[model samples]
Target chain A: MGRWEPNARERLELAALELFRERGYDGTTVAEIAERAGLTKRSFFRHFADKRELLFSGQEQLTRLIAEAIAAAPTSATPLEAITAALTALDSIFDDERRVLARERQAIIAANVELRERELLKGTVLTTAMAAALRERGDPEPVANLAAEFGGLALHLAFTRWIEPKAGEAYAKLAHQAVDELRATAAELG
Target chain B: MGRWEPNARERLELAALELFRERGYDGTTVAEIAERAGLTKRSFFRHFADKRELLFSGQEQLTRLIAEAIAAAPTSATPLEAITAALTALDSIFDDERRVLARERQAIIAANVELRERELLKGTVLTTAMAAALRERGDPEPVANLAAEFGGLALHLAFTRWIEPKAGEAYAKLAHQAVDELRATAAELG
Candidate 1:
């Protein structure tokens, strides 16, 4: 719990998201984010490569979470099952408090084409990593690739649905529902 | 036949690909591409919104093609079936010469992350268009989305294999192989 306390990186991320939402991604500056977080610009640079990285550093964490989950799924699990498990595992990281920040991040991304591209790239990177993890779990080539990509799509759908103003439903529930819909879609296609 | 015989737009696209490959995407300018194509800078702007648009102008045609194919597919066709039909129909547009150009474009994009993001965005836009078209054709929400997103994944896999240096293989054949693998993966998941 002590380790969970706000550090320089955490403060920078929160401050950057707030500033990006208020002033727009392009309209804001690294100095502003650092100053808002009560940190130095040098600390901000040490925490992130650039402004884009500020918005996208979570992608690194996402890849780590999904790849780790896929690697940990039972060897007997099918590729799709592994992907589902991996995605479901990610839902815990986005608690109710984080959901608000996630929604604002989505809104900021939606308003900026550059940010949207970064978002898509992040998804692509995660899918690619998940596929590799599945392969390490003994899944074959194209099968692992397809399953990981479909999982990415399922996550995208869940994120879209989860961000809407709703009751106290957890993102994990929404994500699981989206995965079920994906399975149904596959069944229909089959 | 005359209009098809290398208009300014065509010349610019060809010239731009060459220059991009030689000098890198960021190293080249509209003026350089226009001069190389023996056209004025105004002519380049008339055809594309920006330098990035020159590389992605084909996305407009792709959206139109896939959407029209979905609309024109048999009413009884399943969502996946319609997407397959649409993608296969796209193959005829890529002749041997265009395949070479496509390979060059892929190489250029692979070397540049900025261009890679745009490429992903183009795929996303196409998938979204395909989903909307499926909806217009009476498919359900997540089904259309999942099917369309899967179709995009299939397209990605096929393009990856198709662009490989093979012995005079057609892009359509590679695409079919990828789609078959996608179907198998989907069935396995089901």
Candidate 2:
């Protein structure tokens, strides 16, 4: 059943994720993923340079979109509103169709030491981009940097809650609540 | 040289850092470190499991102190205040005598991917402990978790600023400012 599929990237991603889950990330091979997707190893290479690239395929595009979204947010938007808008856009990006894959991706990342470091580096990249966006909006450097960092942290915490197996809160709702609580906490500081 | 040394750990740490900076982390060996410190490799291992352990030795102690400080904050303390107080205690722990080692340790961690991952894991452990402390303060579980994560992120950012080579800002002052801005950004959400 080697029928041609136009969405080879998507097919390879699904196959890789399945294989990674069943066999564990280190145990999965490029050839195995290609075979599962009804494609050759060459085709898999076309889609992803390596196994790690398969896991982070959309990272660059997603980071860019989020940065631009935050930058294009209304000037009248409060820092929290601006950050919230950006985070909500991220939620929209992680729709039901992507949630399962995202969860698997998150799990793989959490379980691996090297992947976790890359994840932190990615988070730093996004935070830096967001801070730059804020700075372009006339916010001071340190404030913009700190706001993006703290806001990103709030969003990350909320995402953790949203992804929890038994968590009752909705993603957007919990994110908003988290931002509020974070603000309140910051207010109480000297 | 070893005969006059009262603090073997301190002596070994300094020797290691100096060698690491001069020859790079991979270039420096335990034998060289021990030799430079006028001790044996056996003496070095007695104090540390390996070179990496020297980089993280203070991290464990600092995290423990922060955890305890957060847990013991006044019942009436607000979230940020409690976190700030914990960090202030941390700053005191990183007093003048410790600052040089602290900077060197950070530099070493920065230069290595594996060390950075270990450092991130260490920070994650501290974040978890801090969250447990906040939960014990009788706050709602989700809020407590979010607060702990936010505090960790803020502290990380503040530490980033403090470590900048040409940064003129004092660690305590920069940290206070960063926390203040975090509160303002949070208030903007309202």
Candidate 3:
């Protein structure tokens, strides 16, 4: 009822995820999510443009985190090293609590065509951000783009592994391992 | 009009592209497209599910072409070699005629957010197909995926270059160049 509501955004996201899981994404509604969150529809709108946006709320922040990390890598770092730094920086957000949410979110996306497409589009955007950052670091064409893609691939593989129910490795460590595996694979591409 | 028409699919696609260029994708209607193509709505429906499908009609064929090419590569071929064969196989479709259409299609997709998202989704699907094909060739987990990602990146870079107004190189040549450039870039990723 008051203008100041604590954790309104987080509450709405949790409510939406719960409703989506219980009734299916298509079966859930914005008003129902707001009601479940004990928040007003206006407050829900203030945080997310739509139900789908709730699932992807942190994309901009994640992009910024990656770009900044790549930029902040030491000048002597190779493109892959810069990418490794960016991937490691993601540990700040992929904590245990977020991992659980990620697992649920992945299942929800897997079951929905629209959400899957949106996820792919988001991945493409992140890859483009990584490439731009690499270019800014003076890595040339094709190399910058290719290295960014490798970074994107590693991030995806690491996230997938980290979200496994029984997986015990830290996200950053998994990312480093994935990048090394990809490098070895590339080396064997003769 | 007879139920059977010559070049119905191609006509519908060309008409749709022209209308989308002049009236914008959102502004153009299927009825208008059919009319412009000198056909009825029923005829248009017979050829395509909708206006968007016209631009993406060859997706299945392209997927098949790449998969079959990879599968047919020599048993001793490296993962990247198989990918190279698949890229070269694309010359069967990327002829001079398709080049013009590709340019127009790219412009239309660039101007429309929905189309751009759809394009990105298609790219992801193709990448998945490439990875699956590599896996079938006995390449390991991350290796299969990494090689496929590299192939997808090459296809994208080659396609972008091929669509440039002043580009003179053939699509297949550009594709080979892209793959080599990516390989060199990967080797330098230190």
lDDT of 2 by residue, A97-169 (tens): 6666778889998888777767776666677778888888877765676678667777787777777777666
Worst 10 residues of 3 chain B by lDDT: B1-10
True contacts kept of each: 0.56, 0.20, 0.86
Candidate 2, residues B18-82: lDDT per residue as tens digits? 99999999999999999999889988898899998887787777788887888788989877778
| Residue pairs in collision within model 3 | none
lDDT digits (tens) for residues B36-131 of candidate 1: 998889888888888888889889888998899999999989888898887877787766778778889888988987888788789889888989
Task: Work out candidate 2's RMSD over C-alphas.
Answer: 4.5
On lDDT, the candidate that comes out on top is 3
- lDDT for B145 (candidate 3): 83
TM-score of chain B of each: 0.92, 0.88, 0.96
Candidate 3 docking band:
high
DockQ of candidate 3 compared with the true complex = 0.81
Q: Against the correct fold, how does model 1 do in TM-score?
A: 0.89
TM-score rank order: 3, 1, 2
Q: Report the CAPRI category for model 2.
A: incorrect
lDDT of 3 by residue, A40-136 (tens): 8998999899999999997998899999999999999999999999999999999988998999999999999889988988899999999999999
Which residue runs of candidate 1 sit more than 4 Å off their true CA positions? A1-6, B1-6, B24-27, B167-169
Please give each candidate's TM-score.
0.89, 0.78, 0.96
Global local distance difference test of model 2: 0.77
- What's model 1's interface RMSD, roughly to a tenth of an angstrom? 2.0
